[model samples]
Target: MKQNIYHQFITKKSSGKKSFAVLIDPDKVNAKSIAELVKLSIEAKVDYFFVGGSLVISHHLDECIQQIKAACSIPIILFPGSPSQVSKYADALLYLSLISGRNPELLIGQHVISAPFVKKSGLEIMPTGYMVIDGGAPTTVSYISNASPIPADKSEIAMCTAMAGEMLGMKLIYMDAGSGARRPITEHMIEKVAQHIDVPLIIGGGIVDPEKAYLNCKAGADIIVVGNAIEKDFSLISEISAAIHSVANVNAG
Candidate 1:
């Protein structure tokens, strides 16, 4: 099997270069908007483009991915909410299992249903342990998954959850605060989880500014994902990317 671009990207994280990704929810943003976002992301030197949402009530996923691919050369990775969100147009899929929640479906039921189609699609399958941490708001992912978000201050629980995911052979561990969060995951929480886990750490949700992004990276996040903030202010793409890149440069130096 050919190594996917995302897999290769993760492999390089050990070199201490932090990465930045822009997340696009296909349901909320139209194809034209996605094209524009991709253009901006490319100009900002973003490392990846994440496509998906918690509840995809719309049917424009393929359209969204196609538009992004048409406008940019960056890797398009699927951050799917459910089985229905799969599309062949993406370069990779974050085959996520909600390890933090007790929901059976999110842990395995959804994967069982989506596996065949995913396998056929030939997209790089990056099995990820997806954990939702309390972000000071009720987000769609927690509602849709029918699972409770881990308490914001539970670093030990988060660490153990991530460790379990790694032991289960997950390629990545994603700690999310869900969209529209009032607070991003704390640097202490990220530090605790990253210290216990061996895989790349992806931190997302409610990161409203470059300073927050910088803190997450400094706390040991391998890839910092920004979405809602970018939606509100596209200029944040450049600022956040620069912040992450600045950290990477300093780390390398």
Candidate 2:
């Protein structure tokens, strides 16, 4: 059997080796594009490929995962937006709970519907506390969940929420600014939240450039996720990966 990828992430965090994940929304990219992305991803040396989207109106999810797996050796983790997004082919699934939201549906309701299928799929499940920070616009996730994002400037709220997630035993805490966000998760928010949580912190959305990716790592994000950025410029996968992984995790010790 293959080693659990979640354990690998924990080990990487403990060793102060930051990681990068390329989010591939199945709804946005086709099989041919995914093949190209996988090749670029291999050259970039990304730690993980996050597969899923906020709303998948097509039947491409399973096909996309299979194609990426065939072309890339790296582990593909399912970052699903809903229960239907689960796939057995992926190495792991981020069993997410919208801990930052007040909506009962996203917090636990959906889990009840998806639990049976997830267990049957035999995919490694990593429970994640998903938090949405305002990225200066309305995002698909925010709209779909019907939950307001925590204000970006309210670092205290982010800190409290993250600490609660850690206490709840969530394996990871994901703070996203939403895909195509106008702004990425701020350094202050990342710093405040990371200080309060023990699990690996994953930040995503609006990370369009290498400099922003580097700053997020320096601010204490253990993993940085870039999606739309890579879609705009395939070469950025390597640039952003290097920029993020190169930063020293000052908080690791």
* TM-score per candidate, chains pooled: 0.97, 0.96
Model 1 lDDT at residue 239? 93
Worst 10 residues of 1 by lDDT: 1-10
Instruction: Name the lDDT value of residue 144 in candidate 2.
Output: 92
Question: Which candidate number has the best TM-score?
Answer: 1
Clashing pairs in 1: none
Which TM-score value belongs to model 1? 0.97
What clash count does candidate 2 reach?
A: 0
Which parts of model 2 are misplaced by more than 4 Å?
A: 1-3, 249-253
lDDT against true structure, model 1: 0.90
Q: Model 2 lDDT vs. the true structure?
A: 0.90
Candidate lDDT values, in order: 0.90, 0.90
Query: What residue pairs are clashing in model 2?
Result: none
Q: Across residues 67-171, which tens digit of lDDT does each residue of candidate 1 receive?
A: 888887899899988888889998988999999999999999978887888899988888899999999999989888889999999999999999999999998
